[model samples]
Target chain A: MEKAEILGPAGNLSSLKAAVDAGADVVYLGFNDSTNARNFEGLNFTEDDLREGIEYLRGKGKKFYLAINTFPQASNFKDWENSVDKAVTLGADALILANTGVLKYASEKYPTTRLHLSVQASASNYEAINFYKKHFNIKRVILPRVLTTGEIRTISENTDVELEAFILGGLCINIEGRCYLSSYVTGASTNTEGACSPSRFVDFSPTDGGGMTISLNKITLNRLSAGEKSPYPTCCKGRYLTSDGELSYAMEEPESLNALSLIPDLIEAGVSALKIEGRQRTKSYVGTVTGILREAVDSYYVNPASFAVKKEWTEKTRETFEGTSSTLGSYAGK
Target chain B: MRDKMELTLGPILFEWERSEVLDFYKAALTLPVDTVYIGEVVCVKKRSLTIKDIETIGKDLEQAGKKVVLSTLAIVSNEEELELVRELSKLGFSIEANDASALKIAKDAGRTIFAGPHIKTYNKHDAFFLESIGVKNICLPVELPKESIKDIAQNTNLKYEVFAFGKIPLAFSWRCYTERTYGLSKSECAWHCKDHPEGIDLRADTKENGKKAAPIFTINGTSILSGKNLSLLEFTEDLRDTKVDALRISPQYKDTGEVIKIFRDKINGKINYKDSSERLQALIKKPLTNGYYNDKAGMEFLEINDILNV
Candidate 1:
């Protein structure tokens, strides 16, 4: 059996180099536009930046994947097509796409180009996975963070495509590519604009009790007491009052997904690659996470039965996370 | 301009008792709707109405001179859900493919498919792609603006349906919020969502100094919906001009029959836009919004005159 690959996120040339230097087998990034899911301003790469980043990865004998995952607008489908053409021209190892139209264009125009389905596609079951494989010849699929390890094993047994599972990073409570809450409150479509809880609509005001309240589009998402850290005002992680007059985190709390202890189970479930989320994070995050996960994967390969998570690794990864806590997410079977 | 448009009743998104489910469809047989979508589209754990029950309902609706389409789950994460979709495809009724997995299963079985809103048909290319795969009709995504809908309708020959009324579905998650709120695990949820057939209203105190609570969203099991009902009755003229073939009304817990009657009257020009809009507002307790149709924040309530002037 082949060793699983450690895929890391890189927003710029510096992060790309950091990930590569820290022993990431593959680094994924996106162009600086709404064509990608993490379409935040001042993040992502320009054409010049892509050239440098790709060069850096090739020098280190590592691979890089280009993410063109957002659904293209009817008025400007050419923008997505142009990105596909550019990615192939720039020698991307694979194209991570979410929309069927974009997948059709990439497959027909560049038949030999390797295609991988992005998690944003939300293709969770084997039938959906096989559909993409049959149509576009997708080589791998980044599984959505909704399935348990047992379910992953069942899907792997049923489909012939390689599976890439998220092992670390911010967790999306809602299924990817299907959420419209951000657009509901802010008028910025996460599907088209590629941003959720966009920064322009976010406001933080100090209260009389010395605490702060975070609002998205002037709609309060949460009220933090004094010394309590506030998570990003994404609609899902917000605390709201239910019909029963109780205020609580109705969707999900602010917690990152850490699957360090489940690495062996994931490997046994036939996951070929382990992906770490957060391309919008800093370079140090990319470096530290990649290094720790790299050691974990290596240790598992060395001695499968005796492999165990180190306390230092969990502590280091937790320090770089968005929230103070971490969860096994759906991988633990509800 | 198109003079006639069909009225479609979307599948029940909330959990209801089996008897209540049958009673609703039995009453739907007498409504003015032209087509009725029946199935569990939100969570697979919902087993109030079995496939056998849906088949029985589909037959009765068909005999009553209404087209019936079986809707699939919006999220297919496991083999159990996939098997359910596969079984649904085998039934003789036309299947409404909510997820790509259902789309594949139904298309492969040679079933006529209506691409549901969750399929993400944002561009003409997406519509064309689904059309090429034998999809005959498409329900546009909830967040698309009027202009984009016009562009797609102009480019594709497929029948287009817009979500014209009811609470807009916002997001779906694996963790059941209904179970989470009750401090129960998903496996042992005990069907608590049945307690709130209309969904649990999620509100927040947006005002800094006021004690008023503003409704934010509606938690329905694993899915979240916009707190306000989306009523496009005032824009019937505009939608007619956009060349939409159908308008969909998602089933609410109560007053759905009255809501359907008002929309039918407006479509037939018996009641004017303002009168129909006023009646709908008075009928439902929740507020109404049309911001998504006007290309603004979906939670905003845009006036009809303001939309027309723009």
Candidate 2:
């Protein structure tokens, strides 16, 4: 069995250091703004922070991947293009990008820098994966969660590019990045705007009756009992009234994916790297997930048959899980 | 100058027999519409017709005094679909850019384009941004209220198009719910979607604590259309006053020409809005709805007189 790279998300300088110390073979970070997917306030790296972080990782003999993955608006190609140039100039190992325009530009300007396709592009099958490869010379693709393990194996067999799979963090009910359900209800789009279920659109109000109602853009998403905790009110997870007479999760519930148990299976299926999501998380999260995945990857290498993952491996990953809920996600082929 | 407003028949979205599609477009030439956007805009795996068939239809529509534009698939899942978009662009005809990637290619080719509603142009800022990117026209998302559309239209420089009739396309994706229903993988879907041309209707049970609520229509992986088709034939006056440049009527499995004629009479002022609306409703084989236009919950409907007061 070949070794699989353990990747971690770095929201800031502290998280970057923690991820490195915790055994991250490669750490991924992004600049603040739409150039990266997690375009939140007070998170992500500054230019100096990126520079310092890269030097630290290089000294430790580790790799750094820059996420310049957001889609580029027709007139806004400059911001996306400049980030790619900066990533190349800063000696970053690779770029994880979603936009075709950005990919085309980077292939022309930085032909040597490895290009990994972001999950935002939603390329599920071999044909879609190969399309990106032929056009932009993408080296690796982060497979969308929609695929089953069998499908992933088949795709890897057909495509020339390496494969990366998400092992932990937020699980999107709709196809990641391709989802418009949030934007349809809240006016903030995840695709171009880098914000889905934007915080401003969410409001939690106590009902006159004992519970609290979590609303997104004035539409009630879900309600909780007096003592119950209200989940984040994203449109996909919202409780709604439909035409056929029902009140339920019209889309899905808020849950994080914990795929530690499937690490060996993914490696067996020819996965090149393991990605841990949630760049908006704390250093504790980055450290914890990176540590566990690192051990699992190393164990799989030492003795392939001895690499049985205990429930505790994924349980350790659960501490960094979002929304206080976890699922095996699509990795088990469901 | 043309005296009549351009009526564009949206491309076929379902898998119909190739002969049926050819016959439909051939019959569409006699209608008073101005333009016809031909070709498939749904699943890429449907290999019923080739690009040559679309070109022949475009020629026939053009010879019938109607301009023709080819539409690419809405979801560009893989390389084959990307090649379809590239081929459509190389055809040297007007194209409707559905996805952002399509818009990028259309802009690269410097082709004048109609931006599909799926592109998400919400406010005046977005409209202006798209206009700057060379989108000559835009179809507001079906879920947007008429007031927002009117407000944005009043401020933006780009032409606005409204969904006048047909089953609204609420969403699209790489997963084929229709195939998944039969316990089959999307790759080996067997083109099962060819069986349901309108869409296979589904019901969701949203009961919590033993209370019954309205069940919403859940269709394919891509679309969650309203139980009722969007009928705006009766509101042509209101739509026109919003300064909308055109009204887009999506093609269904049947009676497309009659739907186009009813809207034509209303837009031409040949009949009153009420009379035109009643006749249009009577012509439809199914229930009609204008919920999204009224800006209420997507499934709710309002009286025409009440809509006027609002």
Candidate 3:
């Protein structure tokens, strides 16, 4: 059986080096702009940083992918085109794109560059994946985190394009590209602006009763008691009051996706790569997650029949999570 | 002297009973809508109307002198949903492609495609690409401003439409919030979404005092909608000038016929903007918002005077 390549997230030069040193076969990073999904402040790479990181990865014989995944608006469409131009010019191993406009430009402008359909495109089915492949000569597609392991197997059987599945990190319960909860509150859009519940609009204030309230654009998302670890205030994870007058996590409880046990199933399902989501995370997090998953994959390949999830791997990944707990997400089924 | 813009009744985004859906379209046939989009665009689990039912409804609407378009599921994850898109595309009605899977299937079947708002046509380049693939009309995403719509219109000759009214669809999740709120799992949902014909109102407490809670979002099965309705009745003049081809109004549970009439009257110059705006405000239960049209938050409401001035 062919081993699935372990793909890691790299926010900057340090995270890139950390992921490479921790045995990630491929590391993906984005420009410090709205072109990528992780367009947060002080995150992602500068042009100089991209050049230096590419050189370092080339030296280490590791591959790097560039994400220009966000949908481009009419006003700044050129910026996306420029990012595509720059990424290909920098000798990126692959370019991950979400918008059809960007895909058309990249495919026509640079016909030789490898293109992976971003999860933001929300192409969850094989037909959609094949559509991208047929139109742009897309080489791979990152499946959304909404499919079951069985469904992934069925899709793999149908499409000839390579499939990449998310193995770890922040879990978006909503379909990525279709969601507009962030833009409904803040004017910024995750689709167009690549910012979801942007940190600038998020405010944390202490309550009178020694609790803290997290608000996005002055709308109270959740109120945490003192000493409670608050998850990042994305609209989907927030607790709200239903019409029944009960306050609950009506959408989803704050949680991260940990697919450690499903490594064998995903590989058998024909996933060519396993992606660890989170370009906004620190280098320490990038290193720890990449290292743990690397060990799990290696152990599974060496002796598939004897492979079992080590408790220490799960515990170590839990430490770097934003949510209090982790789940297998949609992989195991609802 | 541009031609009068048409009004399209978008597909039902909520889970209504079979009889209710049939009755809704039966009434829609008498309304002033030029085109009627019928089919399920939300959760596939809520199968109140089957493919046969949709075909019957489409036949009835077309016989009533209305162009009928069938919409596909917004998120096609499984084979069951993909088969539905294929089946609908072959049904011979015009197809509204909500996802790339549907878009490709419908186009391959030689069905004229209407790119739904979820297809992400943000720029003229995106619109041009869709047009190249044989999409006849494009319903711009709800987040775009008037300027962006005009920008796309200026660059492309394809027919353009904007979501003008109803609870704007905001997000979708794999887990059914309706079931989760009622303390049930998605697998055992038992069709609980039919209980709330509109949707469950999700409210948040006000910042001024924790005593009052304002409606923030509407939890409809797996999808989320804005708590308030979006009305562009006051901005018909602005829309007319943008050279848009049509205005889409998502069918709500109540007063849909009246809403369609009001838009028709406003578009035909029978009712002025103020009277039509007031009439719509009185009909809707929640507040009205046109913030997205002005390039602000989707939930924020811009007053009539403020919108016109801009």
Candidate 4:
């Protein structure tokens, strides 16, 4: 039985320690710049902070992957290039990228840098995966959440690159990086800026019916009763009344993707790494999930028969911070 | 600047029948549009029409004195889609690259392509970059303001295409909103999009479903479409003055030719802007909105505050 590495997020220093303590073999993080996708305030690390973070992780004998995932616009390409150069200068283990042009430039300019395809690239199948591998020397590809375990198996068989799949995290209602819904509703860019259904454009108004009305730039997203949970005000996940007079969640409800049950199957499908979703999460979230998954991965590899969807796994995961109540997403695969 | 603007009929984005699609092009031949993009750009599963369908439509449109372009899907998720895009690029007809992967493949194939509106080409730099990659015409993203369009049009050498009439595609996604709405997965979605020919409109959500409380414009499979059918008839004169080479009219559920004729009359200076707008708005099956072109947010009507400088 092959043991896949458990990757965790470290939004800040405390989160980094938590992830390490919780048993993450490798931790991924972003720098506080436009280069990384999660370009949020008070999130990500500075150069000195990254250096310190690297040292801290090194002391724990863990690996660190620096994410520089945003596709650079024509003017911003230089900024991204500089960040990649800095990441390399800092002895980062790997670079996660989505932009074809950037991948090409990096592969040609710095051949030694390990490149992992970001989920934003939406390379779901073998041919798309092969294209990235052939052109930019991508060593691994992050499978989008939309794929099934069957799709994952087919994709893994077709590609030589290591496959990483999301086992836990927030569900992106849009197709990975292919969504323009966020940018269209709000001027902010989700692909490059790393903010989805950006917070700036969303607002909550008290509906006449006592529930809250979630609004994205003044378009009423949904009207939830005051007692009903008001989801994160994303443009897509809200309920809609279609032209057919049907009222339903037209896109997806605010839910977290929890695939702990699929652990043995994911290993069977030849996934090299199991990644957790939230990067803007707290230290507690990073530590708890990382520790739990780390143990699960170990137990499964050590004795497949003894490994089960333990009740404790479910309870511990539920205790961790999630966008919604945990869910086993659509990977019973096509 | 040319006094007469060219009208480009953008590709039929939905899954229309092969016969209906053929009939659509034959009708488009007699319409006021100078160019037509014909292909299956939306769902890969909706294969009611094939390459043969595209070839027949292209030949008929070309014979009818219209330039024909083949369009690619906006969100290419897998190998099948990439292969489809590559095949589309190889077609002798002009191509409209909607997503980045298509643009890359088209560029690599050395084909002169039309950069579709969904490309999100925001500034002069992005425009210039597209032009460098052999993009002859660039459709402005729907969310762009009039001023931004004007600036981009004036600065870029490539021809600019704006949405003139019909439901502007606000967004495209991997998860089919239609399937999700119907409680079916994307693979099992039963072509329910045909049910709402004008696309679905998410009304004001008065009932908030926790975390799910947001204005939803569910179309097919996680795809949230725009609430209002985009009406730029009032802005035709402004568009004309901005050196816009073409105005794109997307084919909707009904009265598409009539909408084109109304735009033609406005563009030819045969009708007043307000009357043309009113006529077009009345003809549309859905409510008219100029949200994207206006500087205001996508949903609300633009309001002028009295406190602004006179």
Off-target runs (Cα >4 Å) in candidate 3 are B207-211
Q: What tens digits encode model 2's per-residue C-alpha lDDT throughout A1-334?
A: 3478889899999999999999999999998777888877788988998888888888899999999887654446588888998888888889998866677779878888899999887676676677578777999999887666766787788888999998887767556655655655555657656767778878888887788878766656677768765345666566555443345555444577777777778887778899988788899988888888888888778888777876777677655554357777656643
Q: Tens digit of lDDT per residue, candidate 1, span B22-74? A: 99999999999999999778888887988898899999999999999999988
Error of 2 at A198 (Å): 0.9
lDDT of 4 by residue, B24-82 (tens): 77788899989998765677777667787677778888998999888888766566777
Cα lDDT listed for each candidate: 0.90, 0.73, 0.90, 0.74
**CA lDDT for candidate 2:** 0.73
lDDT of 2 at B284: 76
Relative to the unseen true structure, what is the Cα RMSD of model 2? 7.0
Per-candidate clash tally = 0, 18, 0, 23
lDDT of 1 by residue, A123-201 (tens): 9989889988988899999999889999999999999999999999888989998999999999998888888888999
Select the stronger candidate by DockQ from 1 and 4: 1
Best by lDDT: 1
Question: What TM-score would chain B of candidate 3 score versus the native chain B?
Answer: 0.96
Greater-lDDT candidate between 1 and 2: 1
Estimate, for each residue in A255-304, the C-alpha lDDT of model 4 and write its tens digit.
Answer: 77789888888878879899997788888788888888988888888887
What local lDDT score does residue B255 receive in model 3, on the 0 to 100 scale?
94
* Model 1, docking class: high
